[model samples]
Target: MPQIPPPQQQVTHVNPQTLEELPAPVMQQIQPITPGQVRSARSAMEDMSAAAKTSPLTPIPRISSQTVSLSAGASIPQVRVFPNQATTVTFSDATGHPWVLGAPPYNSSPCATGGELCVGYIPGSAVFTIQPTNAYASGNITVLLKGLATPVIINVKGAEPSVKSKTVDVDYRLDLRIPKRSPDTPVYTATPEKKISLYDKQLQSVLDGIPPEDAQRLKLKNAPGSTKVWQIGDELYVRSNMQLQDEFEKTLSAIDGTHVYVLPATPVLTFSVNGQARDVEVELN
Candidate 1:
């Protein structure tokens, strides 16, 4: 014998003052949904929910333009360093050339260090490159720039073991500045901006080995094979094959199977392979 169904519950909005259910409002329009549409939405959501724990675990660096300015009389700030990655410090004159020389090309002191932080640069140029030789390297370095009133001190340290966002501990690029350029410094013409295709400006930048200034690097914990990801504004730039089922706005086809696709930005990105959803794996490029 068939079982009887339970009574259904009716939900209605009520007015606080009257404590009575308000009259049901008439529907303006009836939006239609086919059975297939409902199933597709539910399947998509389930795929994402299946691997929440395997999503990106590290905060990826977005391609950024603003430099961390080092000013005089400011407290020494620690710069994150990583083994095998070089952190570069550069001081360019108003002309954009290394400002290590004076009106007559003279400098007072070279880079001085006393730690496992290996520091090196051109003898007279105002660019210093540093690499941490030890995994737990912790030390400081002082530099006396030419014509500067005071020396610059940099505190270096190892990656913290307890930080979730520690993937960004990879080497950082540094830009140094002086209070003012000397009076006798001559003005030089600024270099023209490198021309990039208007259609593929952002993707082209990555291929050129320099991402656009405003692009942010997103760290992907499980990027698809050989795929890289970046975020520019609301768009997610992907360097991978075009075997994608989801809709994408733009793409750059490459002779190699790997290509760049502009996809919708989401907290987590998943790639569909053989009807199965897989999370993308990535690292700092």
Candidate 2:
């Protein structure tokens, strides 16, 4: 049989600096830390410090303008952020593709109020470049300038709370003016009257039966002859001339409802048209 050696006994050392000194074996068992972990810990501290100083949210101003150009047709505008202010602006498209637009990039930096949030529209990429560090101010740029084709939601946060959002529609026509510098002013000019064909009495009777409420909404009372006419919400109540009643009845037969109420507009004397003064039957519509 092989013989086994007995374990050695441990001893403690006392020192002037401390009450106890650990055994040599105990001290040797402790492993040294790697440099990589130390570097990672330092980096984490730096990141936390940066986050503490930067704000997580921003705001945008409520802007109103009449000169919006809807030609872009659903693209977000480019935005420039001014100095000393910050805001958060968001954009969404019909495709469920969403992107953020503001002074600073969503997680980049902060914006300065009274500063510029310059938004330029690019139809292709639908991207906005926010310059939070830009030196421009609000008054220097036009907030209502039509840049994008689509609507955008803007949240302006800083000195004041403001929110604005709008979906723009495209204007199919070009805007032309006879050389005027001021957009704030209105331009008007009067021209000679033009002749137009008039509606006949039979047509007028049909027109007259129209209820004021319905006529006003359809704008049919004073429209031109060729305009394609269509009825609105409910079926109309109609009163017709006697001679036209039979013809009108056939027309009403196609329209489903008890809406047509026929009455004569004038009295018919039996003897007047024939040669005798017989009993007269008057038809009023």
Candidate closest to the true structure, highest lDDT: 1
In order, candidate lDDTs are 0.54, 0.29
Tens-digit lDDT string for candidate 1 (1-285): 999899889888776887664443422233256579889999998988887534233323221111123555657745566666677666543322345732121112222334576776677666677677655777776666677655566677755543645344344665543434433346432222121122355664564346688777878886666666777777877766535445566654322334456767865666766668886544433
In terms of lDDT, the poorest run of 10 residues in model 1 is 59-68
Q: Note each model's CA RMSD in angstroms.
A: 26.1, 21.6
Per-residue alpha-carbon lDDT of candidate 2 for residues 1-285, written as tens digits (9 for 90 to 100):
897889888887767788587887776566344579778989999999999765433433332111122344532233334334433232322111232222322322233434344333444332333334443333222122123323333332113223343322211111111111122222331110121001122322333333343432222232222221223233222322211222121121101111122222223322211233333333222
Give the lowest summed-lDDT range of ten residues in model 2. Answer: 189-198
Q: Could you tell me the lDDT of residue 48 within candidate 1?
A: 84
